[model samples]
Target: MTGVPLLDPEIPLPPDFPNRMLTHMFASPIETDIAPSGTLLGLLQRGRGDGWLHALAAPRPDAVAALNHCVLRDPRPDWQLEHRSLYYARLYRELDAPLDAIGEHLFDPVDALEECEQRTGLALSVLGHLVTAGRQDALALLRRYAVTGANWRWALDELAVREDDAGLRELGPAILARFPGTEAGERALIEAVRDSFEPRPWHLWAEDPARSGQRERLARALEIGDFDRWQRQLRPPTPQPGWSVRAVLDWAREGYEQTPRQWREAAAARCLGAVAGPGDREVLLRAAVEGPSPVVRAAALRHLAERGDPAVFELIQRAAEEPDEELAQAAVTAYARMNDDGALRQARGWLERTDELGRTAAVMLARRGSAPDAPGVLAALRRVVRTRGTDAKELRALVEGSARLAIGPAVPVLRHIYRQTISSQLRGHTARALAVTDPTFASGFAVECLWDCEEETREVAAHHAATADARVLDRLRSLAADPAEQEGVQTAVRGRLAPS
Candidate 1:
């Protein structure tokens, strides 16, 4: 009663063992056959075909059940008891039975140690096998074993490799904290923490128990080796634990959504940079069309074309047809980087579909060889700037490069934006445009910019002034001496004003 003997009297404990393990020993070895249950067999197959027991090929479920029942009903003989008990343990693990159920019929640690004066070798073997099997139920069973500080070393080491990240982290730390001197104990502890943050690619699922830790693992993986692991893991396999395609997409979307307005633009940019694949193309296309931020939408549009996706051409055309000038401009920029007859035709068709302002934009973009110019492109650009509310900077910049091509009526509009615009930046740019045709016109804007309040205007003015006026040196010298002038303004004026 004290030692809680399990097998027949002929059966005895293996020689040379500690006593405490006997307390938790089984009294009656449970029955199991050479062949296990179908569920158990299937579980083994799923686990890379390795398991605690060798599976029987084409096993008879009835024979297995009969053998299992016989073992459970009778006390195993002395010589066969060790094998019998071990077999029972294996069956229990396979069937996912509770360890305490086995323990309740077996030895109790305190009383067994007082009477037996030796550990049960049978119990040790069962525990060791469970640790190595790495099955979830096996792990649960191993936790019930008599875990002395000495036994803790082997147990912790095995757990580090066989258990999931969370389990290893838990058991490994307990071993190290309780048995600081044992090398295996200490190593297991460190490995648990290290592997949590830097998981091996083959075993990401093994590390998912601690999601924050798993995230840390992913981040560390990205830094380790050109991110081949991240790229591989995140790619097709349809779905896997740590780096599934859909999960990554969702993660990036979440970040973009939660970020502050100022930061959302940057986050979306980074997300787009990281996410590019066939399936992701639609997501990016939708973002290009309907993203909340212009910056995000523009970048998505540009990258689609940059990625050399043929589908982007149609999307670009669709965006070009939108009433939003920003989207239209982005699509135009993307179109410029592309070369496709379809895109050109689409852009032209959309342009023809719009009224004067959009028509002018389309014609300006089309004239650059993007599409065949509508017979009316140049004339439309002129009319838009003259009578429409087109931005002067835009009209002038458009006219600057194209005016030399007998751009017709747009030339006068460019001159008008140049002379009438209030923005020195626009005026200076328009002036430079005019300089491309008539240097005198550029010189006039240059003088006007010099008298302007904005430093940028003065800089432009000085640059233009440097190209004109025989008395330029005198003008700069006089300006440099003026006490009212800022040092930067004086220096700029002096630099451009060559000495007589």
Candidate 2:
């Protein structure tokens, strides 16, 4: 199968088109120049609601072919990131698309059992939606897949949402047969029964006389799970008031020696904070500086920083400069949390250094610095981008700080990150920064953002995109009328359309 040529929006593919060609078509970017809503393929790529409208209006065979390609292949880079299944399902209901393509795709011999869920999850979700829309064919197809498919648990859960007891009862033996009669299989079945998203089908099967053994196992597992949760709550390893500060520190050190978990040390720090008396300040200060274990030392620093102890600032400075990466990071985190003016002053002094501690100081200033600190934040953002590029996750705080401080010089860099970053969430943060800093945002990127895959990005566009362009107004109107549009987005659209 070869890729489909870029065709006119109105043109339909031949009915005999190959399935692999559809995959190739989606693998490449859409070639259309207009808004994604203008073409069926482009709309699908963007996962826009307009795709549903466009697909419905396209030639029936062509639309069905395109929709099947998407459901079967799973085109999105991240399925969890985009909204496609519900949109595709709604179109299926409107078009009454046949189930043959779906069945063939589900039963394809090439894909292994491991790949089945990822490949068919969207299609299964679509079928689930269609069944809810009262499509008998959809329900029957779901039942067939649940019994025969490798991702049967997913299919079963879908059916559980809409299928009645009688419809569900007939499938118990087939579903149960997948689990062997061995101990391992029984354990797997217990886990499946315990973790099921929808319990209706399991509940129904558990009551049946033929499945009494499976029912007893499931009930036992559920009881143990509940009791375990209760036991954990009743005897949590919290700090007691009678323990002295040294004992609390030793208790923390004991956990660190056994498991070496960072969070355990942090929890212990909170315990030390509760138990430490005024007379124990000097002892804690000494531990923060020279404790035997780095975990104990870091925890002491964190506790002292929280207490607003004056002597701890120099200790933080020393720890921040330490060669040990974990201790340094913990020190920087503690320094960032401090509310003292001296911490801010120290942050300003350290902003010129080019090491990790320097970057940490810049981030601290970006987060807590006033408007006067915009230049330093902008400098840190550019330095990180120039050195590490936009893919750095560490740039998130600096990106947000650049926006919060409204640094005009940061707009170009922010725009660069927005354009080049693959992360939808990062792009969202960039959009928000642009909304505040870019004067022309309403007339520029805001228009394109209306078709963004992330709802929050769309919400930002809705609130800020200039209504001057015909495209923006049309999209706003479409979003306002679509019941499936997020409530935050619709609220923004209404605010824009509201009579002044």
Candidate 3:
């Protein structure tokens, strides 16, 4: 007769035999009320049997699981009395076990930290002996323990020395509270606060509710000149509220001397809101002109323009000549907003330069197009669109300018550019431009580009193209038979290409 397999063929053996054996050895009987009711007898059964104790005593990594199973399946008062601390320590070790294996008892953060600290205290007593015995690895092991849990002060202090931002971030507020006024503690608090300002996803911001509190904490730290952490909080999307404008000004004034582009930008943005006296404008103006960051220069130009001084016009003129496109754009936009004749004259002069520079100058010029010179600038833009290559920037200028000018000449170029430019942003703009310039110019090119583009662009293109080009109907008919395209794109294309 053939013997049955010890394990069923369908139930494959675990890769680690010791863990599998430990698991199997403590497997309860089918009818064992091994549920809640079996606890008392399970404990009594443990002492009477060699199998449970032998499983616990096994010399393998799975030994921990077997021991826990023995204690949990049947707990006894005498067993606790005999091995209270040992059992607690072993259970603590399982806290670091794989997540599925981590028991409920090991999850109490406060209790785990306390026990870990106590174990560390006792372990340190033997460290001297180990050192004397030349156990180099022993020191490293002790160092690891010293850095774990509630006793993480030393690690934070060490991390601060190495300028480890992520490490200091992990140590977080608990270490901040523990170390208080110490330099490392101060630095950690500052870093924690500053890190809070980093641009996070909206979902992430909601998830990290403590981030607002962390920001407040960082702000308080800045008052005392813990500059490192104070500045950390100034990253993107964080609106730097006016705490002490004078203090921030002082820092900006000091910082701009050697500040990186990002830091100068942050400070310049802050100073813009601060009500500066006459001399403050000079400081800010210097930063705008010679500051390391173009963004900072842009902010400074904005600050000066908003100051209501006619002098800001000449300052902006100088900035508009700067090589940095973003700063020049800011200057042009600012000058347009002022709407003075001098500002318009400067904008027109700048428009005569490169297309990249001309784009911003044209936008400002378009806004002021009701002025006497507006028609000439519009004509120049019409020329640029018809003649320029199919780059995204030129396409955008063409499409946007055509919509603004409502010029018929832009129709062909916009259509051609839409077909050639790979950028979905430009493609969508081209469709809209064609619709705006002359809705009848909509054709197979519009439908083809819409099909070729992605979500937002496809939606925009379809909306304009279908409304204008009835021929998009045949294109949709052909697109329907194609299997390779996404359903969302096809559905949107169909919806736009549908009647009306």
Candidate 4:
């Protein structure tokens, strides 16, 4: 229920779409070795607001080289999710950087066979921004890539946003050629039309005045795409666990038979809320604690813990210490789902332990703990910064909790996270927290935050940065004027302005 459009996972999607196999290997998070922060490469890698500032001060050749390296290599911890492309594109514009390096990277035939959006998404995104900024070369390159590249859809989506209606109309035949007359081809075309990240091009082609044949075909695709989406909305596929406790237990057993550790118990547990009754409580309790089926036992434990069943509270505490790490994680997650006073008390009790459950407990308090819980939350924040540093995923929850409680004492740690974390999202969270906890933020990070890589961070800066600083005023006015800035950031900038 993320509100994101999804293809039916039960049906086979186009093999060309990103399919992440669990068996596939991955490098560690942010493990790509970055140079010193003082260097241009490192600054861009970190996506720092001041990256361009450093680039401007460096030699033009050095700056261009660093910028090219970053754009081509993709320095993000997770390229699929990060926001470095627009930032890099802006730098490219500022530097008037050449497109040769980017062009070469985009067309590298060596990596063409293994077509993942991860390969060219950042480059295409940067080129998209450049095209919007009036780089005709970028527009032309994207047009060509749409025909030849493995990641052509990304290029097409970019073109959809910035290309002229005439330019889009010309591509109708090429896009149509992607599907042949076969049944599978038609379905693929329908799926592509359905799963498109941007629909403007499709919508435009469906009604092109001069191209009656293209229009008819595209119109059919649009009609079918809309119908498929509507059908999915009207009746979601049936749940595998069905509508009763016994059915759920049987489903869990079936899942366990397929994969010992990859059982359907967690999903089965979710169904228990609708069907379990007084008659089923003992069965659930027995399955949770003593059942021969590991899957049933796990599901029952999750259901009970999620319901905050006091009968299973001790089981939660003990299971978190189980020899099976997956079971321990499942048990701890169930414990965190509890929203009762007893859960809060349990979280408070575990504040001293540094295990996963202990950390989850600390986060629980940080999120839902009261005024009296502020001290514990602050202590937890400090301890995590000391133990795991600012980039730790755990810090995101704790930083938000600190902000929620307005814990002034947590300012130092929040400031540290803002300064040290290489993650733009984490830095954004820290910026928000520091706005409340740090009085000096208006004159300090707030000024630099105006130039931050992430739009949301800049939005926060706009709301809080002091008007007295000359840099703040200039940056805010620029952001207000910049068409490339997000609507939210521009709105925030406008809110802080005097009426012209």
Highest lDDT: give the candidate number: 4
Write model 2 residue lDDT over 397-478, tens digit each, in one string.
8888988898988887887676545455677788899899999788877876776656788899988887877878887897
The list of candidate 4 runs beyond 4 A from truth reads 1-31, 36-38, 234-243, 259-262
Instruction: Look at candidate 3 and give me any clashing residue pairs.
Output: 190-229, 194-232, 194-233
Native-to-model Cα distance after best TM-score fit, residue 483 in candidate 3, in Å: 13
lDDT of 3 at 225: 43
Regions more than 4 Å wrong, model 3: 1-250, 253-263, 277-299, 322-346, 355-358, 367-388, 392-398, 460-500
lDDT for each residue of candidate 3 in 66-180, tens digit (9 for 90 to 100)? 4344333332222212222222222223232222222232223543435333322222322323333344543444344334444343323323333234433444444434436
User: Which 10 consecutive residues of model 3 have the lowest summed lDDT?
Assistant: 29-38
Ranking by lDDT: 4, 2, 3, 1
For each predicted model, how many residue pairs clash, with residues at least 3 apart or on different chains?
A: 10, 0, 3, 0
Candidate 2 wrong stretches, greater than 4 Å:
1-190, 197-228, 237-242, 259-263, 481-483, 497-500
- What TM-score fits each model? 0.36, 0.70, 0.41, 0.88
Worst 10 residues of 1 by lDDT: 42-51
Of 3 and 4, the candidate ahead on TM-score is: 4
lDDT of each: 0.45, 0.74, 0.46, 0.79
Report the C-alpha displacement of residue 437, candidate 3, in angstroms: 1.4
